[model samples]
Target: MVKSVAAPQAKGKSAEDKIFGANNRAVALSEKLGADKVINGTVGSMLDEDGNLIMLDVVQKAYKALTPKEIVAYAPIQGYPDYLEAAIDQCFGESRPEGYIRACATSGGSGVLHHVIHNYSEWGDEVLTSDWHWGAYGSMCNDNGRKLREFELLTPDGHFNMESFKANVSDMVAKQYNTVIIMNSPANNPTGYGLSDSEWDEVLAFLKDVVKGKDKNIIFVSDVAYLDYSGEKHECRKFFKKFGNMPDNVLIVVAYTCSKGFTMYGQRMGAMICVTPNKDIADEFVAINQYTSRATWSNSNSAAMKVMANICKDPAKVAELDAERAKYFHLIQERADLFMKEADECGLKYLRYISGFFITIPMEGSQKVCDELEKENIFLVPLGKGIRLAVCSVSKKKIHGLAAKIKSTLDAVGAKQ
Candidate 1:
């Protein structure tokens, strides 16, 4: 073989995003057979009843009104001042926890993940998250020269598995003095699961105990990328208050993104909001993440930042945006509900789903089932242990009977449930 030129660490890297691969196949089939005949459930974004991408009306208008300077000018490495403030205000909503909070704009929620994995963990250290997590978490950890360890996400009765969580976390903290723990919640990806206030309390209490006598640091990251579509605004955010007055060693970072919430997927606007009782740590958060931002993407999208700032600063615009988002939120929820109801009636098992865009069905030979489903023009993402159906992209009419179809597909493939 010819001598490789890439750095040793980068040599064997290949792009194998199965989700996008499956989507490409779905799109091709849609073109061949027409859109109505193909059930394309491989998308990660929201699609309307007619299968068109849904962009918020308010967001579109704000973008249209932006001046050329606003659209083209570079944003501060730390993001525009107003945008940072608005990000914090919007992220916390009524559940603004008491802490020395700070925000730094990132390229997107993915950028926040990149920064946290790079800055918080040591090389070769294991970053902790749930077993049934967004696949990108593992990819990020691998890219950052760290390992990703997972705790069992759910128990036998379909609840948060606290025992497994504590056990795995204790092991990681014992091995590595500092551990970065990522909890994607208020609508976790793939499973559509959100922890309740009581569940949050259990997690915090466990972390508090883990650091009782050790020189340890726990960087808790909340990936709230789907928070807007999860539930009622304030009601869904109540668990945020649990972050208040944490041990100085336990730092909470909320990775807030406008991709799903504001329908600004292409804009790549997001922020990393840190909550800590220590002012010094909060200040250090901004200093370090901004430096990373400069080294990474240099700066975020200025037009998206300005649009958010302008909309957030005006109450009327905020109201309009909220109403528009709520409309789509309900639409997504209705689609989720329809599939869930059918799943329940058909005795199809799924992970505990509270609110979010996707729902996962646990099974063996998931890839086989997904491939078989594709033969029927029904496209879904196959996870390691389950099939992730994008309820966000499927319309209510199409969502109906989907559970039954999947159940039959699972049986046809001889995939164990």
Candidate 2:
């Protein structure tokens, strides 16, 4: 008798299931928030008058310009050569880190993260990162049967805790598992903190010691998702140069996404860059990454890649785009500053935010507080640990109401105690 071999029940939840599950957290919270005017900080997009995303203008123009023939064809599995070259040049700029490196296009930054976890790390391997991080890190690792380990992020003085970081690295090394450390910086999400040159030196030194003469591999992945939002562009770009000089045991992978920078969220175009000490390692990393990509999403959107490449290649267009983006970036800063000022006036302490879309405010029972805020038509993410306010999406006119709502929630919670 021929036995039917049904596909192995998929491990964990399918990607679609996971995404919807994650989103339901916000949806549930929103529903509880009631009929109040909702200022949705959880959403990542900028909306128009009709509540549709405003940033689609850039993408629609790019799409209309493409030839019908181009739209109908398949992009190379590795991605268009021109798109790859343009993306690499735009990211690395003139410095072009002095190593043999290659880039592969992926569905988005999230896809790149999943590919790295599956391709490079073994099952049950541990990924190290700060305690405060984008929530998706845990989801990605868990779905793949990998453990997510964290180190305390702040010192007593409220700076990047180097000692704690090094100790965490040592603990992971002693366990003898291949480790991947993801640092999201320049303009980090949630807390909005960036590492200084000194802190970077400390991290590199610790990694050097951990991997010294040990045949085991260590991967340092940088998620530069909010790179363009930083006020100091030159300083932010300088950090990429450090990756060029790391040892061979250290593989530097940069996941750069156009979603946030170009306001191309729906396009889902992003690059997975692997930089190695020499040509051979670079070639191998590229091959493995491409294999992972093929096994997963195949290749990313061809039309989006072409548009990004064209815009990046034209200097005049690039300048115009940067100028336009700067207006929104500054608006984010202005709104954040206003909120911070009001938070101070109300004695509502929050984590220091240099530059980024969100700020985390500490409060007991954050989920409860978030629910209450929703009743007032003020919506934000309840992070369990704290409340994450997306300053970028909330209009300047809405800042005062947000501040008042947050302060009242905190006060009520404190009084109950």
lDDT at 350 for candidate 1? Answer: 89
Highest TM-score model number: 1
lDDT of 2 at 275: 81
Model 1: lDDT equals 0.91
lDDT of 1 by residue, 1-417 (tens): 867899989988878899999999999989988999999888999999999999888898898999999999988999999999999999999999998999999988998999999998999999999998999999999988999999998998888999999999998888887889999997888898888788899999989889877789999999999998888888988889999988999999999999998988888999999999999999999999999999988988999999999999999999998898788889888888888899999988988888888999999899999888888899999999999999889988888888999998888878998
Task: Please give the lDDT score for candidate 2.
Answer: 0.76
| Per-model lDDT | 0.91, 0.76
- Supply the TM-score for candidate 1: 0.98
Clash pairs, candidate 2, are: none
